[model samples]
Target chain A: MTSSSLIKSFERVKEDNRAALLTYTVGGDPDKKTSLNIFKSIAESGADIIECGLGHGANIGDGGAIQDSTYRALSGGIKTDDIFEIIEDFKKDYETDVIIMTYQNKIMAYGEEDFIKKCISSKVSGIICVDWPWPLNLDFAKKCKENSIVFIQLLCPTTNEDRLKNILNDAHEVVYYISMLSTTGQKLKVSSDEIKKRFNLIKKISPDKKCIIGFGITADTINDFKDTDACVVGSALCREITRSINEELNPATNVGNMVSDLKQKLSS
Target chain B: MKLEKGIPLIDQHDENGYWGGKFGGNQIAESLNYPIEELTREFEKLRNDETFIAERDYYFKNFVGAPTPFIKLENLTKHLGGAQIYCKLVSKATGGAHKAYNAVVHSLICKRLGKTYIGGDTGAGYAGKMLSMAAAKFNLKCKIFMGTKDVERQSINVFSMRSYGAEVVPVNSGSQTLVDAVSECMRWWTSENEEAHMCVGSTVGPTIFVKICAWSTAQISREMRKQVMDEFGEVPKDMKLINCVGGGSSAAGFWNEWIDYDNIELIGVEAGGPEGSSKHAAPLTNESPIGVLHGATQYVIQDDQGEIEETESISAGLDYPGVSPLHCFLKETGRARYTSASDEEALEAFQLVSKNEGFVSPSLEPSHAFAEAIKIAPKLSKDTIIVVDSCGDSAKDSKIIAERLGYKI
Candidate 1:
C-alpha cells in the first residue's frame, strides 16, 4: 500500500462510523509457510491495517505471549528480510495498509536510508520504531517521509504534555496510542471516555493523523478504542496462532476465524 | 548526534547511544512512566553534588575499607618466572567484591531520590549482599531476585542477604539464571514508582546505569593507578589488567582509566563451558552476534532464531548471556581484547591461585581472569606487570567447592 492508501484506510473506516482493525502477527512463528497462511487469513478477515513484527526474541515491549512467538519465529529461522516477504504477499492480495513494527537495530544495522528504500520497494505503507524517542529520530523520520513511507509514531498514556506536543505537531500518517504502560498480553481495561480524552489531546495538535490504541486490548475491551481510528490486537492474536500450531489445528483457518470474530465485533 | 562528555552517572545519551542502542533504548522508553529527560537531568545534578560524594567517601574510608590493598604477588610471579604480577584485593572490600561500590552509590541515589524501596538482581550473590547492606544503612527496604537454581546453589549467600534485611525472591523464569533475574528486576522496576531505583547489578542495563556503574567501578582503576605509581615510581609500561567478564562491571571499572591509553592492555575473560559454547555464556569468545538483552546492545549469545541461550559456568556471576556494551565497544574499537577459559580451566585456575597465592575467589568469574593471566604471564618479560582483579573472596564458594570435590556440603 502507498502512503495515501494507508491514510485512506482510516478515512474509509471513519465513513462507516466503525474503527479500523489493525492486526499484528510475526513473520515466521513456526515457519514461513504457516506465517504466509496466517497473513493470508488476516488479509481476508477485514483488517484495515497489518502490523507485522520483525523477528527479534529480545523484544522488551512484550511479555511472555509475544516474546514466546518471536522466539518461536526466530528459532524457526525467520530472518529480518523475511518479514518483507510476508508483507509483500499480503499486499498482493489485500488493500489493507501494511506496516512493519520493529526495534531500531534492524534498521540501524541495515543503514537507515537503505532500510527505507527496501520498505518502499516491498510496498510497506509505514513503520513504527518501538524505541524511537521524541526528537531523536526526526532525521530518520524525515528521510522516511521524503521516500513516501509513513513514519508512524507511538505515544503512551504516560507521555507528558511537552513530549506529546513535540511529537504530535509534526506527526505523520498514523500515531499509535498505547492504551497502558503494561507490556503486551496483560489484562487491563480502558474506558471509552478515557481513551477519547487522550485521543482528544492528540486531535488538538494534528487533526489529520490517524490514532489507534494497542497493548492489552482484545474483543472484550474493543469498545474502549473502537471509536478511535483503529485498535491493535497483537499478543492475543499471536497467542491463538501459537495454540493452533501446537494443537495441529489449521493455522490459516484458526487465524482467519479469530480476526474475523474481532472484525465482526468492531463493525457491530 | 551530539556527544556529551564521557560521564554518565552525570549525563545520559552520548554519541555512542542512549538506553544503549536500537534494541535497548525502547524497553525503558516504552516501559517507564517517568520521562527519561527528567531522570537524566536529576542524575546530572546529583553527579556533581558534594553531599553525595562526601557520603560515598566517608563510607569507603570508614566503613567499607576504601583503598583496597594492591599487593605484588611475589610468590605467583616467582612460580611463573615471567611477568611481575600484582593483585588488587577487591575481595577484602565491603560485601567482599567489586560490586559493593555501585551498590553504595545507587543506595545513596535512592536515598536522595526519597525512594522507599530498592530492588536488584543477583546470580552469585555478592551484588545482592551489597545492595541489601546498603539498603539497610540507608533505611530503605531492599528486594533481590535471583534464579531458583542460584538460590539453591548459592544458598549461603541467599541467607547472607536475608541476614542483611533483604527479601530474596527466587525467579522461576527463563533458565532461572542471572539474565532472568535481570528481567525480573526490570519487571519490578516498572511496577514500582519511578523514584524507586533498582541497583542494576552491572554496566549492562540502560545508559544511565552503565555510566553509573562504570563511574563507580572506576574507583578500582583510580586507587590502583595512584598506588601502583606510588610503589613503582612510574606507571608500568606493559601493564595488563585482567578481569572476568560476566556483565563486565569489573572490566568496565578496571579499564575505564586506562582505556584511552595505547600501551596498557586490558583483557576481559569470558566463561567458556564444555563445548566452547555460548549456550551457557561465552559471548565475546563465542562471537555471538550483537543483539539486545536487558536494554544494551552487545554480544548476546542467542541462536539464529534469536532465542537467547542460557549460559553455563562454575561461577554464577560469570554465567550471563551478554556483557556490558562498554566492553563490547572496547572490543570492537581495539581498546580491549576478550578471551575465554572453559569450566575445567577456570576450576584449575581457582585451585592453583588458592594454593599458590593463598587466594580463593568467592565467584568463579575471576578464575577465568586468573586462568588467562596465568597463560599470558609466562610469555611476557619480567619488566611487564600483569594486574589480576581478585574481585571477591571465595568463602561463599566453599559449599560448591566441597560439592565439586565429592564432599557433602
Candidate 2:
C-alpha cells in the first residue's frame, strides 16, 4: 500500500504512546468563514486528524447536536463544493490529516467517479460514510483505495463475527468501532472496561489494523479509551459550537479551547 | 375458500440487497445490522412455514375479515358511462384500512421472533392504530412514534392507538412528519433492539423491511387473484389496478399478483399538493433522483444540492418525500405506470364518491387514486375495467376535510 498521511499520523501518535485525537466539526457551520477558522484552531489545538462533516438534509446516524450543525450549515447555503473549498483552504496552512464525513447520498448524487476526483483535488485524506456499512461499501472502498484515500469502515457492538471478519478483511487504514448502540451525542452508558474488552477481541482478529472508537466520546470520557489506537470526538464538539453560539462567544475560540481541553484530558 | 401462503413478487436478492439490481438495498448504519439480520432470518423462514401460514390465514378470516368485497360500482360507472369500474373495499378491513394486513402480520412475526416489545412510526396514525390493535391481540408492549404535527392532524388515530394500549410519542424535529418519525423510530430501535422489534409501516426502509411488508400485504393480491378467477372466467385483458403510493404498502399488496400478467396494467397515484403549487409529494411523477432515505435507496424528492425537500399534500399520510423502492423498480422496468392527483382533484373525488356511492369517509390517500380513475374512466372503452383499492377510511381526516371544505364540522 502507498504511504498516506493518515497512516503516517497514526504511526506518529503510536510512537508517542498515546491514542490519536480525531476532532469532528461540520464544514461551513455557523458560516463559511468562521468554520474555516474553527478547523485551523482544532488542528493547532492537537487534533491529530480532522473529520469535516459535509452538510446534508438528513443525518439519521447523528444526534441533535450534529444534526443541528448540518441544518445550520445547509440553511447557510453550504454545498458539497463549498465544503471542498473549506478543506482546500484548511490544507494550505495545516499538516493535520482531514477526512470528510458524509452520508452516502451526498457522494452518490455527485456521481461516484467524479466525487473521488474531487476528493483528490481537494487534498482530502480519507472518508467515512455514516450509512454505508460493510459489503455495500466494498465497491466505493475500492474506488477510494485506487485514489489513495482511506475509506473508513464502521462496526457496531451488534456486528456479528462473520460480518466483522468480512469488514476487517476489506478495511484499509482505519476502522471506526461504534462504542455503543445509540446515535452520536448520547451519554456513554457502557463502561470503559467493556469498551476495552471489545477492542481486545477485535485486536485478536486483526492486530495490525488501526481501530478508533467513536460515538458518545466526550472530554469527560476521553481518558477511558486512552489505551486504544485512537478515539473520535464529534457530537460533544458540535454541542460546544451550539453553546458558543448561544452564549454570544466566538465559536471558533470556544470550540478550539474545548478541543485543547479534550487533548489535555487524554494526555493526562 | 381457505387462505394460503402468498407468493413473493420477485426473487430474493441476497447478494447486493438491491431490488431489481438498482432500487432497494440495506443502506443503513451498522447499529441496525444485527436486528435486521435477526428479523430477516426469522421472517424468511416463517413466511414459508406451513404453521405460520395457517396462523396468519386464521387471523385474516376470523379477526380482520379478509376477502373484503370486490364489487362493481354501478352508479359511478353509469355516471361516467365509459369503462366498467370496480372497487376493492379494503377500507372494510379491521382497523379500517389495508394497513391491517401488514401490521397484524408484523405483530405475529414479532411474537414468532421472541420479541416482547413492538414499535413503529406513523404519519396519519392508521399504521399506529393497526399495529396497536395487533399488538393488543398478541399481548406485546407497543410504542408508536408520531410527529407532533401528525399528532394534531391525526388525533382520532392517536386516540384509537391509546385505546388499544399503545403509547404514542410525539417527535418535534425537522419537518415534523412521516420522514422524521421514521428516523426517530430507527434511532429508538438502535438502543432497544435487543428486546424490541420495529414494525415498519410500509414497503420502505432496508431490504428486509421492504420484503416483509410486501410479502405480508401480498395477501391482498392473493385474494384479488382468486376473486378475479371466480368472478369472471379469467383475468380481463384490459384490466387496470390503481392505488395510492405513500411508501406503497397497499399498492404493493394490490399489485403483487398481477406483476407478471401482461394482460393487466398497474397505475400508482401520488399526492400532487395544491394545483399549480411547487410543493408536492409526487416523487416518482416529479422526477426525483435516486437517494437513500429512511434506510432504503429510492427516488427521493430533493433539492439540487441533494437535501431532502419538504413535501405538501392535502392528506397527512401522503405527505412524504420518498416513494417505495419497489415502486421505483416497477417504474424503471416499465411494468407499472405512475401519475399524480392534486389536492383540488382529490378533494373533489372525496365528495363525489361519498355523495354518489354512499362510501362515506373514504380516505384522502386513496382519493388521489379515485381522482385518476374518475378522470380516465370516461375516456376508456366500455369493455375496459379499472379496480381502485379504496384502502382506508377517512375518519381521521375529518378535521382536514372540514378545514378544506370550509365547514365547522
Candidate 3:
C-alpha cells in the first residue's frame, strides 16, 4: 500500500520534535469564496493539517462555536459537492494534508465507497466522523485504506482497555483522543497533567500509530498536549471566525493570525 | 408479578446491537461506547436478578399502574360497524402516559448504578413529567432537556416537572423539538456521564438505550397478551396492533410480545404534519433513506446533502424526523406495516374518540394511531379486531387541542 499523505505529514512533524498544528475550519463558513480564502490562510499560516469540516445540521459532538459556524455554512448554501470543490481548490494552491471532518450521515448520504473515491480524487488526506466509532466504522475504514485515505479513529478517556485495543487494531494512520468527556469548545475539564497521563497510557498501548488530541485543545491548551503527534484546534478557530464576523473584521486574516500564534505556542 | 422470561423478539439482536442483522447498533461517539457498554452490562445483570425484578415489579404495579386495562371500545366498534375496536388504556398509567413505565425503570437503574443525578429529554413533556416524578420518588436529582418551542407549548408538563423539583433546561437549538432535545441531552450526558444517567424517552437512541426502554415498556404487551387469552380463550385470528411511532417506544412495547405470532399484524402510525404540505414526520412512510441520527442507524427525513429535515406536526410528541432502527428493521423485513395521519385527520379522530368512547381528553400522539385505526376499522369485517395503544392523556396538549378546536383556552 502507498504511504498516506497524512502519515507522511505526521512523520515530517515528528522530525521537527513538535506536534503538528491541525487547524479546523468549516468548509464554507461565512460564505464559499471567503471559506476558500480561509483555508489558504490556514495552510500558509503554518498549519500542518487542515481539518475542513463539512457543514451538518445537527452537530451533537460540537459545542456552540462550531455549531454556529456549521449553521452559517449551511445557510450560506454549502453542500457536499461544494465542499469537495473547496478542497480541490485548496489542494491546487497548497500541499497541506486536508482531512475532512464531519458527522456520519454526510459520508453515508454521499455513499461511503464513492466518498472515499472522491477523497482520493480531491487530494483529501483523511476522514474523521465524530459519530462513527469502532466496529461500526470498521468497514468504512477498510474501504478508505484501499484508496490510501486515512480513516481517523476516535478515542476518549472513558474508552476501556478492551475497546481501545479493538479500535487501534483497526485504526489506520492516525487516532484522535478526545481530551475530556464533553462536546467541542468546552474548556479542558481535566488538568493538562491528567490528560498527559491518559494520553501516555494510549501511547504505551500503541507505540507506532500517530495519535492526536482533540475536542478541548485551544491556543491556551495546545502546547500542553505537545507530546502527542498532533493537536486539533477546532472550536477555538471557529469561535475566532464567529467573533471576527461579529466584530466586522476580516475572518480569514484573523483566523490565519490565530493559527500562526497557536503554532508559535507549540514550538515555544 | 414476576418479570417475563426471555423476550425472544427484543433479544433477537446480536451482541453488537443489530436487530435482524440489519438495523440498530451503538452508532455513537467513541466516548459513549464505554458508558453504553457499562449500561448494557448492568441492565443484563439487573434483568435476571430476582431482587431487582421484584423491586421493578413493585414499582410497575403500585406506582405506574401496570396492567393498564385492555378493554374493547364498544361504542366505537358498534359505530364503525366493522372491526371490533379494542383499546389498551395506557393513558391510565400514573403521570398520565406510558412514559412512566420507562422512567420508573430507568430511575431504579440509576439508583442501582449509584448515580444520584438522572436526566432525560422530553418532547411533548410527558417524558419530563414522568422522569421527574420517578426521580423525586427515588430521591435523586433530575434534569430534563426540552426544546424551547415545546416548553412554550407544553406548559402543564413543564410545571409538573418543576413542581417535582426537577430543573427544566430549555434547549434553543435546531428546530427546538424532540430531535434537538435528544441531541442536547446526549451532549449533556457526554459531559455528565460520570455522575448522571440519561433516561432516553423513546426507543430511538443507541442499541442499549433502545433495548432498555423497549424492555421497560414491553410489559404493556405482556399484560395485553394475557388479557387477550383471558378474554377470547386464544389469540384472535385476525388482530392488528396499532400505535403511534414517535421514536417508537409505546409501539415497541405493545408489539414486541406478538412478534413470534405471525398471524397477528403490527401497524405503526406516523405524524403527517399539516394537510397537503411537503413537510411531515413520517420517515417510515415517506421512504426516507437510511442514515445515522441520535446514535441509531435508521430512516431519517433528510435533504439531498443528508442534513435532517425540519419536521412539523400538530403533536409535539410526534414531531420527529427520524424513526427507530427497530422500526426500520420491521419495515424492511415486512413484518410490520406503517402509515401516517395528517394533523387534520388526527384532530378529527380526537373529536370522534372523545364523543363516542367518552374518553374526553386523549393525547394527540396516540390520536394519530387512532386516526389510522378509524380509517381502516370501518373497512374490515366484524370478525377483525384492532387494538390501539391509548398511550397518553391530553393534559399536556390542552393548548394545542383547544386552539385547533377554535377555542381560546
Clashing pairs in 2: none
After superposition, candidate 3 runs with Cα above 4 Å error: A1-3, B1-7
Of 2 and 3, the candidate ahead on DockQ is 3
* DockQ per model, Cα: 0.26, 0.70, 0.80
C-alpha positional error of residue B236 in candidate 2 after TM-score superposition, expressed in Å: 2.2
- Of the candidates numbered 1 and 2, which has the greater TM-score value? 2
Candidate 1 lDDT by residue in tens digits, A1-268: 4888888888888999999998888777777878878887887888888888884544456667777787788767687678777777767777777888887656655667778888887888888877555566678889888988888878877788887887887778788897766667787655667767988888788787888878878888776566678888998888888898789898788888989999988888
Alpha carbon lDDT of each predicted model: 0.78, 0.88, 0.89
Q: Model 2 reproduces what portion of true contacts?
A: 0.63
Whole-model lDDT, model 3: 0.89
For model 2 chain A, the run of ten residues with the poorest summed lDDT: A1-10
Best by DockQ: 3
B1-409 in candidate 3: lDDT tens per residue? 1112355656767777877665777778887877787899999999999999999999999999888988889998988889999999999999999899899999999999999999999999999999999999999999999999999999999999999999999998778888899999999998889999999999989888888899999999989989999989999999999999989999999998898788899999999999988888999998898888888888999998889998999999998899887788788878889999999999999989989987645799999999999999999999999999999988778788999899996
Put down candidate 2 lDDT per residue, B1-409, tens digits, no spaces: 1111243554435466776677778888899988888998898799789999999999988778988888788888998889898888889899888888888899899988888999998998999999999999999999999989999989999999999999999987778899889988888888789889998888888888888888878888889888888878888989999999989998999998888787789999999999988888988997788888977889999876778889889888888999888888788777789999999999999988888788644799999999999999999998999999999997778889989999998
